[model samples]
Target: MGALTPEVMVRSLSQVLSFILAIALVLALLEGYVYLLFFRRPRALLGAIFTRTVQSAIAALMLLLFLRFLDRMGLIADLVAALGLAPLLTLPERVWAAWSALSPMPWRLLLPFFLILALELLIYFAGEPRPSRLGLAYVLILPALIGISFLIIIPFLFEVRLAFSNMAMYTAQNPEFGLRYGIENFIKVFTGPVAKDATFFEVFGRTVLWTAINVFFHVTGGLILALLLNRPMRLRGLYRTILILPWAVPSTITAMAWRNEFDFRYGLFNILLRNVQQFFTDLAAQAQSLPLIYDLLAWLSQAIHPVPWRQDPTWAFISVVMTNVWLGIPFMMVVILGGLQSISQEYYEAAEIDGASKWQQFRHITLPLLRPVLVPATILGTVWTFNRFEVIYLVTQGGPQEKTDILVSSLYKAIFQFYRYGFSAAFALVIFFILLLWSIFYLRITKGLRGVYE
Candidate 1:
């Protein structure tokens, strides 16, 4: 929290260097032991020992340099104090305090490191005779694997632990963990309100509807535009660029802008509707002699009144869906466009020669060929839309009596708003399983992976 200074920078750099050197030294010793155990030739053993000695010497020297640098920067005392090693404490007291601080014995951290070392040894042994590329692949991907473990897998496991606990604002300091707590959390998720007044089924049903509507419009609208752009046309690039602007802009910004545009009196939608109604009224009066035309214009005028988009629950839901659909279309269009272009012109030409209509060609050829691209895109789109929170949160915020709350937004509200940490974790797991099941069912039904594998 303190301001960055030369001393802080030097200390941080020294800590990082020391840690890296320590790891290098450990790895060198581990590899040397593996070599001694595996290689029977005295030459190989001597080479391995020499390599380990050189690596260990370099790492130790680097560690010493970092220590000296930290000492010179006057940061050694600060580091010791940070580690709870008080100057007044006897050596025994310091050791005891350090042991107490590490009471839980970070097996979670050590287990992974040891497992990785074992895996590397196995890979090395396997690859020794035939120089397998798999070891190189693992080395290249090790950083990403570590990142995913820390960022995703670890957090997911922690959330599962929370889901099994009775943790809330009241019991945050000492939450009870048990199978019974997990059962209660899951049961409450289904039976009790997720938000203040919205039940789990109600919010979930709305989320399904929301995802469906947005995905439907996104696919259809993007496909239509892609089809048009696929044909020969002047300024097609310009038109495509303009159409994609909604997606190019950030969703939060677009949602806020659309939220403003849904304003009753001053919004662009209302203003346009009001102008249309007035124009229709004037036309109806002028066309009164023709009763049919007059009635049509009058009806048009009556139907074109400004809507209370934000105030009404249904309208607010519609507003968020519309914003999301707009925000989602460009991605679909780009994906579909690529798929469309990938379809060989020869197929269309042969279909045309066979007297197939446009629709017939699309149904018989284009769709089947595009399935490989479209199915994956649709699945991704569905998942993204189902979990989408920005538009709803920014636009309506599950407003008008929590009417627009989806599962994700409701989960967020439960945690941050209601302080129902345990409940929210359970809610999150439910949503995850729902999406997982849906993806599995969808893939099976669509044979989406078959196309990819084939």
Candidate 2:
């Protein structure tokens, strides 16, 4: 019993079945006509294959539509989708296996006719929610929820479509097949300038450089500091605390602090330079103002001077990389320090007994043992730096010109600045595959065949 009774439900469901039958019949007839008109000549050699595919597809649609109508009509009251009780969908899949392929329709479809007749005679009046369960609404809405699974699969198909197709509607006249977009975009991604005049590949390459250089300095410097702090020296606790201060401070604050410190005027750097330049004597001579790194470049370019640091392309690139390296170091230092603590003292003692030089011990023991932790950290650091926009953008703004745009920042420009959703989506899809392919390649190379982990 429901707000709408079983009788009312059956009446409404009957009408729905009639409506579905009409639609199905119309579509089948229309597609059949279209196939007769257009799909005829292509069937010269593959006629059997084409016919089989068409017939099989059509039969499947018909069977699903029939099952759906039966479910609607309360001919099968179990509503757990393919798991529904009493009548099941497997009847079609199973019984159809024995039917002749050449037949117009599967002889197995006859089973449904008798089954439905017997169903109507039996308790066709049974209701849902498993008959004893409390949630009738759950049962009623179950199929709609199942339908959404297919809905979620659509965007992936669209991305795949774009990946394969040239995608410009104006490319040619009514092309039957997907046009040859080629690996041109893919190649462009790795080369330079993905779109228009701006070169994102160079930006991305610089980003990678930033990552590698940053990690190398960070690990070495962090390890040295960590080892120093680990010793039983005076004020060791205070020194350790001071060393970690850079990492513990918020990144934005640290970045702003560095930005101020690098200012052209009233900054420590210029003051220090002026003191050092005056033969280390004129501590009281008025400290000369050095141009800010970027400003200095513009000034020098005016005077047949050194290449620009922030405006000239090469200098601008270097400044950004240096800043990124500076920003990234503290984090790596902390991670390495943690890794160092986890290594056992026994290895070092054993190395000493074997009369291995410190360098030799480090080379053979430290590096090989550290590889397990460092490899993952290095790879993660690489990806993070590759996509790092905030640090570079806040500092460089891709300035002088659009000379410093990485793939992601460049993608941002395309989406918001250029209003190219499809283009950007395609770019994102490409990047995703690039990362996915790299991951797959790494996994294959690494062969993550774990034995046992507690």
Give the per-residue lDDT digits (tens) of candidate 1, residues 244-333: 899888877888999999999998889999999999999999999998998899999999899998889998898888889889999999
Q: Which stretches of candidate 1 lie over 4 Å from their true place?
A: 1-137, 446-454
Q: State every prediction's TM-score relative to the real structure.
A: 0.73, 0.52
- For each of the candidates, the C-alpha root-mean-square deviation to the true structure, in angstroms, is 9.8, 17.4
The clash numbers for all candidates, in the given order, read 0, 1
- Per-residue CA lDDT of model 2 for 1-454, tens digit only, reads 4597898999999889977875554544534433332323322335445544555655675667566555543333335344763345545544556554534543334454444334322221221112324344544454455456335444565455544444343532321223354354444455645544676556557555666676676667766666555445799767767776766777677656655544445544545554454432232222234435435444433444223345567666666666666666666666766776677879989999999998997788767777766766676676777667775566666665667666677776665666444455567777777678766776566554342231
Q: After TM-score superposition, what is the CA distance of residue 363 in candidate 1 from its true location, in Å? A: 2.3
TM-score of 2: 0.52
Q: What TM-score does structure 1 among the candidates reach?
A: 0.73
